[model samples]
Target: MLAVAMLLTLGLGGPWSGAEKAEAAPAFAKGADISWVPGMEAQGYTWKDKNGNTRDIIDILKNDYQINSVRIRVFVNPSNDYGNGYMNKDRAATLAQRAKNAGMSIMLTLHYSDSWADPGKQTKPAAWQSYTFQQLMDAVWNHTRDVMYAMQAKGVTPDWVQIGNETNNGMLWEDGKASVNMKNYAWLVNTGNNAVKSVSSGTKTIVHLANGYDNALFVWNIGGLIANGATFDIIGMSLYPTASDWSTKVNQTITNANDMISRYGKQVMITEIGLDYNQATAAKSFVTDIKTKIRNIAGGNGLGVFYWEPQASPGYNGGYNKGAWQSNGRPTIALDGFIN
Candidate 1:
């Protein structure tokens, strides 16, 4: 309790005003995730050149685009040259501060791994490399409380939080993996829920599951948690156009998830969804179509759709994936379309 209290004191706290409820939005929320760094190299652009430059996702909302919010990922401790950013409570607090400074609501993603927490790489942070199960639970609670408090102190509390990224199989996977490997998956997930609940009194905590366009199997895996009384405030899922038309896929996706939400009386958020513009000429339209389909299915049902790293264009300087992305890779048009 002392730890959580001290952390919240550093920065974080708040319930958005009633008027701030996307109340003016005639439809559903259209949001994107973009963060500017002094130096960042993804696949193509360099960071030094784009240094001090800003890639404001909120610009879409403030400008002609109708975007209502932005999402940002925070790592426990990225083991890369991204130089210890958004990796800890302090960094997350910094990013959240900027988001609120832009007058935007935020969706916070907690990557349990030191770098990324996608299904393929959910390694626990170095500090917890050998932690016992109970120790890891302590780590999760301490970290969650610290970050939430930090954000509140800065007056940048996230509107929603993903307890762990695309955790389809479970997180910190040495023993949490679900598929034929970790028998403790459910317990691990519930432990994480308790961690989130400790600091989520005014925020909505989401359990995220990421899979290809057709993710019924994985979603069912987590749905079992809900059925078993695991607590969560949102049904969060990640969608990518891997096997079928994203639009058609998202349609079924929303319906399937909403069926669960309708049953549980919970809200939903398409926490991560996108089609790389570099993949095809139809990339732009592909993304726009998914956003529209999501909104159509969730219009009044109160669904939130957030594009994942849709703005990961080349930095003016070198970045992590420098050999791949282009400077103008972000689909500004696609973003404008979704929000509008």
Candidate 2:
């Protein structure tokens, strides 16, 4: 009993009279990709709770909706375009700090470009257009490290960092296209991975791809990366299913996630998911089912699920209709899936 008391007094075990308590292990992460919040707020947008009480969006997400994580995307040198740009490193770091202050974990996605990098497009940043292969690799490392340093300056260490966004065929165009030169893609992934580790070793690195339900694509993409000696900690995916097909897509995605875990021994994260704002009922069911299924993955290899820009209303960004927020400036029932 004396030893126990002494340990407690030393703040090593048990509750103390005044010392800070140890943080509990993080629960299954329910998250939101609200990278548009800053820009939206700047445009005079405000969020309201279900009861119509005006509140900070992050507060509503964390307190009312049970969202414990926030995913922010960082672009290298974004233009002033509202939807296509404005998420450069400094702004991202500021948003990350705000999310951290609200007691939410952070996931930093490095797009390595001025705009979107996805399955359909992976254009290199214009400044990096003239660089050779070696210079491109160096640019990747430097940009990643610089972003990490920016986050560090804000005293926010991201819990997870994605090297690229929805890189189905690979990123950085012809130089790093998987079909044409997978070795170059692998090298880029390694460079980003190494840069992230150099800043914060505890930050897990993710290589993301779109279409989480496509097992063959994952097999080809991830298998190629592994074959060419790519190193990463997690396999991230994007799943955007319509109201009618969500059930089927969710099941298929779960199967693909399991295969990824067993084949490569890496964890899986659903980095992006959404349904149309008008399909609130179906979206609720879809989110509930997918979250439950992902949590049930064997060995706890499933990391978390993040709704893509759930705060946007219809027509906010070039007719993006998939946001979970309603036109009345409140979240729809779709976000209720995270409440449990």
Candidate 3:
């Protein structure tokens, strides 16, 4: 009996002894871009937890969804357009403070425009439209620094800052259009990078682009930036796949993300991802697979995945249909992907 007790104590043999130590989960950021939260709230919208308890949106996200980070978009002099504008520096800083107070890492996306900036349109903010190349560079620097200062004054320093939003064809239109002049785009990217560093050297700067699965696009766009001496810490991607094609898209994105890591020798982040609001089941599967794949990237070069506006119910923002929230003021099961 003494020998058996020693064996069990030392884990030499026993039913529950010598159990393998559970490996700590990797620190892959699971987050959402809730830039639309303020606008939504202003419209008298509110959120509820799984238990039907009314709570602050951020509270619900952090406590219920296990979200570790939040992304906010900042625009240059946005209008009062509902769900379209109003992400100026002060507003952005307030949101950042809220996320920081909630113990969530913040990702600040500087659109550099008064409104949306994406693959289809990278229009310069109206104030910047008439500026020369040199003036444009100054505007980029000043704007970036100002926004960073605003956040800092609020005691909120972002963990990541995207220089531009989805610059597949390059940003600020004709002057910085990659197809027309890649070097100009590189200059703008470098200016933004420098500004971010000046404010918070620790913040990682991202050159965001759409279509994570398109290896050729990544090579052409990011390659252009590299060839023209652009500076950035991470390559950020945006991917939106429908319910039927998520599996294929996820696989392709993983392949592309690995290739980006190997080719660029830099980290990769899924800065934006979403599916139709009604497809909660498929969205859950999609998020789980993508998150797992991103976390498993070799050398831990895969940083994280961020869902775009997961709190928006169906048709909230001018018929936008990709959010993960249900119409009944609660999150759909889709966000369960973030759980370990």
Candidate number of the best lDDT: 2
> What TM-score do all the candidates reach, one by one?
0.76, 0.92, 0.91
lDDT of 3 by residue, 238-257 (tens): 99999999999999999998
Q: Rank the candidates by lDDT, best first.
A: 2, 3, 1
Residue-level lDDT for 321 in candidate 2: 95
lDDT of candidate 1 over 4-102, digit per residue (tens): 432332334222112122112223556766543312323333321123333443453445455667777777766565542334666666766775676
> What 10-residue stretch in candidate 1 is worst by lDDT?
16-25
The lDDT for every candidate, in the order shown, is 0.59, 0.86, 0.85
TM-score winner among the candidates? 2
On lDDT, the stronger of 1 and 3 is 3
What residue pairs clash in candidate 3, if any at all? none
- Which residues of candidate 3, in runs, are more than 4 Å off? 1-26, 82-85
All predictions: root-mean-square deviation over Cα?
6.4, 9.1, 14.2
Which 10 successive residues of model 3 have the least lDDT summed? 17-26
Candidate 3 Cα lDDT to native = 0.85
Q: Over the stretch 1-340, how does candidate 2's per-residue lDDT look in tens digits?
A: 2343233323354332222111232557799998999999888889988999999999999999899999999999888665443799999999999999999988999999898889899999999999998788888878987898898888888888999999999999989999999998988898787777666766888999999999999999999999998888999989999989999999999999999999999999999999999999999998999999998898888988999999898777779999988898877899999778
Cα TM-score of candidate 2: 0.92
